[model samples]
Target: MICAPPEKIFRATRNRPALARERARLARAALADCRLCAHDCGVNRLAGETGLCHAGAEARFFSAQVEVSDELELMPTFSVALSGCDLRCDFCITGKESWNARAGLGFDSFQMAERAKLALQNGARTIMVLGGEPTIHLPSALEFVSLLPASAKLIWKTNAHGRTQARELLDGMFDVWLADFKFGNDACAQRLAKVSDYVRVVQENLLWADTHSELIVRHLLMPGHVECCWRPVAAWLAANLPGVKVNLRAGFWPAWHARRHGEFKNSLSVSENQFAFGLATELGLNLIP
Candidate 1:
């Protein structure tokens, strides 16, 4: 499943197929007893147990076509944010929306495909699949990608905590990977993302991305947590993955219980002068400045 060029995408979707019914079918089947994401809560979404992701059989979510402005090179990339994340990052910016998985509007697979179509119509060259962790709704996600024309390049933004599930989509389904290294150490990972094996899953999935598509690793610099938290993951990527691009995100706006409950109250955002960026430079990573 080599990623086809833009022209191919356009051509493939010249006469877009009607995908609503098939998407519905798959959604119903998957939600019957969902194992779509790594959490594998196995709760019957149709009965609406709302597993760890809080997503039910109904893919309720909010969507908008946004032009990502971070990467100058990818100037015209369109982004779609799906609601609900498996990990409740203390510094989550979209706390209002993603914290409880109840924030975003739910949409069917056809609706999602239309969003991608809208992105292309709006002059975007690529579509970014972001979420409450896209894997939360694996069947719908896969069906959405399958409906799109091959020429449309897809970039999946993930926590990289679900490599086995993520790997299932590696066969030419996605063109780029915009992944995150949320916790630098096991303790931080457990306390922060609530998953001690975060790094292990990410490392394995990253290797899969390296062989399959372009990989960009993003690390948010948390205040007072740089040395004890961000450095280990940064060093690991630099040594184990040389060509992968690194985005030392200076934006970690506090959200959720961060203002009072979590460890981020009165936290300061990272600037160009932050220490993490300097270490990334020293590590010889393909820094995204």
Candidate 2:
């Protein structure tokens, strides 16, 4: 659980919609010289120029549905999956849609917000803005936030690879930061997800998120990375963000380009799963089982 009362967040976020609108405006303006993600690709997306993420001037989404397949405390969430990502994780399960920014329907923030409001009315506990990595679609994401119900719990589900400008714009808007810590080091991150300076960027985002909002960290146990990936990740969490809610997920389905790497050719073994869980417990991490 998040260890926070819903009413406390509700009381504090009365001005969230207004603040999101202002941030949305700023985000759109930044598209002229984009620095949203850690890549710092200064492509002028406003002029049909593309960057590492390949996303253009508008936001697109492949899915928007209410689902309970999330952290227990934040279940029954209305998930809005934006279509593009900055990193190129070859084993991405949603690669067909996520790797290509132009793969989905163009977003209409007001319409999507209305749908999310209806979801809230129908018992959805949170409105989750996820991606491919929402930072790439900052303007639209913030615009969606600006239109959501002020009392609705909002979750920013991310890969934790955003830059300082994004963190500032997202500062006080989200109720929860459901982020992923995929790799423990830069070498593995570069080999697996094609991202550099990974550990520093993710840790910075996590530390800031922990201080700013209700944060939950999740690491999907890979078949051959128990020692090199999860071990260091768990150790860091136990040492730096002790007591933070962590979810050590064991399911690892090899999808998309997973076949390209030997380690990604199969599912996580029972031994790997057991070791990962045991290590998390031994590290005294507050795992949300």
Best model number under TM-score: 2
Please list the residue runs of candidate 1 whose C-alpha ends up more than 4 Å from where it truly belongs after superposition.
1-33, 261-263, 267-273
Worst 10 residues of 1 by lDDT: 8-17
Per-residue alpha-carbon lDDT of model 2 for 1-289, expressed as tens digits?
Answer: 5675333232326898999999999999999999999999999999999999999999999999999989999989999999999999888889988899998899999999999999999999989999888999999999999998788889999999999999999988888999999998899999988999999999999999988888899999998999999999999999999888998888788988888889887899988898899998888998896
lDDT of 1: 0.68
Give the TM-score of each candidate: 0.82, 0.96
Residue pairs with colliding backbones in model 2 are: none
What digit string (tens of lDDT, one per residue) describes model 1 on residues 1-289? 8984442121223222234234435545766777655566778877878877777655445655667565655547777777777887666777656755667676666777787788798888887777767767666666677677766767877877663534653345566777888777778877766665666777887787776667778887777678876789878987898757788776667766666544576464444336777787788877875
